[model samples]
Target: MFIVSLIFFVLFLPSVSVSYANTLFLHIEGKNDTLSIYAETGTQTKSYQVKRLQDIEALYPLLQRRQIDRNSFEQLLRELGIEVFEPIHTFIESSSEIGFVMAENLVKLPLDLLYVKEIPLFLQKPITYSFTKINSQNLQFSNTLSALIISDKTADPENGTYFLKKLLPSSAEYYDIKDINLTQLESIQTKDVILISAHGRIRFDNNDCIGLGDEQISPSHLARLSPKLVYLDSC
Candidate 1:
């Protein structure tokens, strides 16, 4: 009787372990409230709601072409809300251990990251985004370049101070405007590059975007100063 009982316990032990291991619980926090999604060993407890269905549908053929498994493909479909005609068994012959491991270990459900692949989509599509490197190429042009940083003590003191440090290099001659006065403008005589790092609005007439200062310098005032390159850091 003892030997029979031992064999039975060993046979049931693996199933019990797998049952506990396969269960995955996830919590997701949204703007107003929180939500949860649970999944078992080859199935999901809840369905995923997709905002942009068209883009995901367009990409379905590509996923099928790659021959991903039924569970994974279905999971992707549910999350992305795209339909696939092919059977799960035909597409994915064998399930991946790596995929299972990843799914089992995932404590946090991917919150909008998978669906909203690009964040602040507008910000990412800027016309130009480039950084200046402080090296040999920059050194040769430092003397020819001059910067003007405008700052009021109230708006952004830390950012103004930080920009002042970055723009005021040892090799370059730069100016910081604590107060925008007519005398201050008069002091800068032969400046090549004029960087207006302050909050301002710009107006376009023919082909040029004219810079207008807020409360301090109007559109009429900015029209007076003439510089080859004018960089307005503020909007």
Candidate 2:
């Protein structure tokens, strides 16, 4: 019986490990033209996609030169009203042809949805993206009335917390929590800004992103918590 139990445990161990390894906790927020992607690895979380597409696309050629094949390059040019080259087959054969096409036909045109909205998804850290405005001014930081910075023990010990701290006002308080427990939230000073920078997923359901931390909090719950201001920096 002991020998049989050992064999069964050995067979299942790899399966258990694979199951945990494949898990990717992601958060998606926004409606219509706006959307955000938040990803969590264990206790650490990062947020992206709240900026203008043109700015984000500028970083793409530097990061993903290899991924831009000839076909992709031509598609980009046609969208820009540049005359299509006749020798399509020759371009596909050359490894560096896409770079030349991009330089000639599409270089001057502003970044469209293909470059700005899509390419940033492939770049390395710290993942950069923009946020939606509570008010009308999207370009400036005026809409950012309040912010919160949450630090978990397992998160990046350096720049993660530092960036949030720098972005938030000196008046905003910082919190160190192991997880998002609602009981802990009660202690947060009322009418103060609330920012939860933690490892969790925000799901888009029925137009609003549902906040699921240690406890599941709806967008409405967040609105009620601080009527004046609320921002979730969760991943």
Top-lDDT structure, candidate number: 2
List candidate 2 segments past 4 Å from native.
Answer: 1-147, 153-159, 162-170, 204-213, 227-230
Give one digit per residue, the lDDT tens place, for model 1 in 102-164. Answer: 122221222221321223111222111112101111113344355455554333356553454
Error of 1 at 200 (Å): 3.1
Overall local distance difference test of candidate 1: 0.32
Candidate no. 2 TM-score: 0.34
Clashing pairs in 1: none
Per-residue lDDT tens digits of candidate 2, residues 135-224? 111113433445444565443345365565566656455666545455665455543445444443322123323233445545555554
Best by TM-score: 2
Model 2: how far is 128 from its true place, Å? 15
Segments in model 1 whose C-alpha atoms lie over 4 Å from true places: 1-122, 125-144, 160-177, 202-215, 218-226
Candidate RMSDs in Å, in order, are 24.6, 20.8
